[model samples]
Target: MLPQHDRRNSREVFIGNVPMGGNNPVRLQTMTKTDTRDVQATLKQCRQALDAGADYIRISVPDVASVKAFEKIKNKLAGDGYRSPLIADIHYRHDLAIMMAGIADKLRINPANFGWPPESKKKQAKKSGKSEIPPGLLAETLAPLAEACKKHGTAIRLGGNAGSVEHTNTLTKTRSAEFLVNQAVKYLDILEELGFYDLVVSLKNSNPAETTEATRLMHQRMQQTGQHYPLHIGVTESGLGVSGRVSSALGIIPLLREGIADTIRVSLTEEPEKEIHFAQKLLDVCRQNGDNVFEATCRDNMLYIISRTSDPDTLIAEAVQGFLTLPERNAIQHITIEAPGMANQQVVKETAAQIMQQADIKEVGTRFISCPACARTSTDMEKLCRLFRKELADYPGIHIAIMGCMVNGPGEMAGADYGVIATSNDKVNVYAEGVCIKRNICGKEAISLIREILIEDDSGR
Candidate 1:
């Protein structure tokens, strides 16, 4: 496994208020799909995105003419009480990058500018009949832009993209990503020459493998060049919905675990908020890394809990479902997930069942047994029991139960580590190992006692 490399010494810059590079947690940035010309609608999204936990919001600044929405969005954030960093996504026009630096906190520019400065065509490469863009050409052009950003103390996203019209000769997926990395590095090197390093790097491609490969190569290239700059990684053009989430997860997770990227953007066809939502999860966990240069690791060993709400299961399952698939169907040796969204329920429950069930659920911890408070249950004992669950929510690896009475408490909590069997006696009898451990417990410490006992007895199966 590649050791987690502490962040490279890239100068830290803030977008809105979120910081990137340096030792800051990786920033999650997304591009708004809204037309920047519409101030009201654009500000609406800026608010909606902040509510969804987006660390940084990026607006497409196409020309000097469309600066109204930037101010409106900024005003909305100020008036509505949102402080998430706002980033401006610009392309081609160096003037936009420079001008926006004064208005916006950051600028995302394609180093190549899609073959601007007509002279680049000749200076980039010897006239090969086949159209091949020399990645260095983009960097040469970006030198002035980098200098401008340095002057403004503005952060710059050297967002290198190979999908532009200039990057038209993408013979294959690998080559396309290769072309992007070269373009980004060429641009980054220009920053280096100018002694400006307030930048983050990204190489986005639709193919997960290509994206992964490109990042791997770029990291190696940076290490060799002794340039410790932060990286922003994700699979670009990922189709919308679950498929897109899966694609980004497959590519971004491994890089994150190996300590490859400092920030991320999951490019989904859905709303920009959706991308930001997924991006936060990526930041919450570490990514998988491996020793082999070719075979990459996509998941860590720790089991993660995914809330079924908010399409969490679908989005996350698709990313790490290899060993956790449906019916446990795929071959045993074929369990490795090379990319994202590889598994389903069959893999998860079946594999977990086979391993844990064989050893028994007891090996893990207590299986809490509790009933939803309803009219069918008694009020005092049952209601009091339900409210006390908070006392043990953080205590993992233990089973605890709060049952009403003989009606269903015993049946429901047949195998709990601690069961409160309420009886006609008004005495609380604690059941341990399906046998009564205590009765008539009269204190606020009942939950605490059960918690201590459960944690003591359980061993991971």
Candidate 2:
């Protein structure tokens, strides 16, 4: 069993009829991948998430039309007897966010881009040589939305993405854990000043270690300030398949073991229901109070883990939990796993390596990162990602990103050596070293294009 820690003291906040934080069990959430403009498809996806035991269903509302569709989807779900809360994922427009506040049970806004300076304002600032946004501007911009949320009994999540956060200090090129926590704290202070306490905060990074570090720091900062707002924790753009699951586990299990996360989502490049399933399993593994399922023996620099359970999934979860919660995790250089009667021990060993790599404790092979495709995505992300993996398997140590859409794709994949993002249903944009090299090419041709680019780069072209 994982070491138990006391749950953080947080004020209860209700999203629709669901209560989060405080003493309530950790909640699970997943976002729909269907286009929000298609009410039936969106609703159908929401039902799948709910049926998979998600406490909340989030829908991407990128525009005015999506907002309308979101309302229709909400109404249809309610009419059909689904009472799960619906959250609106808003990135750029504060106006749409305000509109969503009145309709959605919760509004998730990126502190980096929400209420960003308009083009007119930017032009004026450029001409006036006063580019700095005036002090109190964020509060002024968010007050209306806060009031609307208050009136509608809706909660707000100040979601900070490591990829999109604007750095005030150009000296720091990378978005560090300190920077992420500072951003979230800034937003928390603003919302508190506005007297909006029904809040949730999340700081996500594509890197699971960074995500975990940022979350722990955020929790510490909040505790120091006596701010007990709930936290929504997840590793954003965690890709797909076993690697994705391992990444999610590495990022989340540590927090859950420490009783830090009040709610969680396992972002995966697959069906929303699959995300729910993995999340549930994660919770089960981390929250167990029974006898430990793993027996570990350390020899010099390597740790050997033997599982009491023969079940593969449970064994993987147990191994992850056992390895991560170790006090001497940093001292260990390698991990090996054994399960009695297990036909393939190689799978378990591979999973152990993945867990270590995902946690940033070791480097195994090629690094793959991809977003959990949302409504903004237009291509078959799962298929494309699989193709990229299969065709590029020989190129170890390289970082490749297969993103779903351009909204946050380019930014999220900033660390990747190469990336492919779907710009439309049939077209994609390819990137090298964060610069787009090809635009609007057929999706079917992206892998070949990437292969050619890789070959050229190998030749020092």
Candidate 3:
């Protein structure tokens, strides 16, 4: 459960009817891995994701065939009653973006690719002995695309990848948080100059730490410069299975805890449906926590309360507010309200009606056990441990120990399915089923290794 933290206010961008940022629910997104040109396969995946609770879906539109397929996929889904927003993920092809502007609910462009000097500009730069494209020309090239987006009411995600930095002069470095921030700011300047405000920012890298730092840096800069654009945070190439899930969580959960990101994608090398599930669960854990709220989970039943007050009417009202905040509200069969004194029956009935009216539970999930960081710890052990516990809470056979010490102290990690020991240098050693399987792994890798071991063992059983 996330401690009810204040959300960072950001500019809201609408994708279809769903609102993102500005205290709106942290939206869930997943990209289809199927060949975009295969309309049947892509439509199948998109429908599967929407059924799994994906707020928005993204599909690559890299070539002309993919564009046509996207159009078919969109029409088919709309025909079948899938009204969730569809995003066109375009790379380097501004023409495709312009073409997709009228079709897609959102257009996600790789800023580094969009900013890269085209062949003509490159040849001119070579002739002039210049290392970069002239700023005016780059802006001119992007303006038409931006204008197209505005005319079509298509939101844009200015996505920056670490791998793309080497190809563009906007940033000459990779894995550096500063470079990531600069790259995003450069493209943001272009959009702002053309009066484009329907934008979100994403800075992604394979390294979880780099991803976190870059996002935090970008969020800080946005706050400082009075830029409220929503941020989309994720780690690129976050692997597969348990390893990918944990690494993605390590990178993403911290910024989310800080209320720095508005939407998240766990870029796992797995089925796109799994990514949606992970991101939705993470958001559920982040949005609903406070001392005034209480949740008790035992087996399939749950007991929840909205307390920290003395008035019966206030207690009932708070309880309704708390219940409505949960993503799993309807899944809960029975809710018992606790008050300091006898509550009014009328108030209870009205509040219950309001909750039932607003409640739309998605699925059953888990509890959280998070701690604060200490000087002795490496990585954000607190966030990692919380996610570890939450992800594996359903497995009663698995016992996990998240220890910050480099060595076992006072028999704290015995009889555990997994044991993690943190070092002074932000590295962790993983012990699986009572034996060491991997060591000297960074925090990002530690979660994945731990998850991988658990999944392997569970499969064996």
lDDT of candidate 1 over 11-124, digit per residue (tens): 455654677766677767676666577677677777777788777778877655556668677877788778676788775566667678777777776654533434545443
- Our tally of clashes for model 1 stands at 22
Q: Model 3 reaches what TM-score against the true structure?
A: 0.62
Q: Rank the candidates by lDDT, best first.
A: 2, 3, 1
Worst lDDT 10-window in candidate 1: 289-298
Best by lDDT: 2
State TM-scores per candidate.
0.59, 0.92, 0.62
Full-model lDDT, candidate 3: 0.67
Q: Give candidate 2 regions above 4 Å deviation.
A: 1-5, 117-119, 122-132, 167-174, 289-292, 308-313, 340-349, 459-461
Q: Write candidate 3's Cα lDDT for 39-82 as tens digits.
A: 88788889998999898999888788888888899899989998
Select the stronger candidate by lDDT from 2 and 3.
2
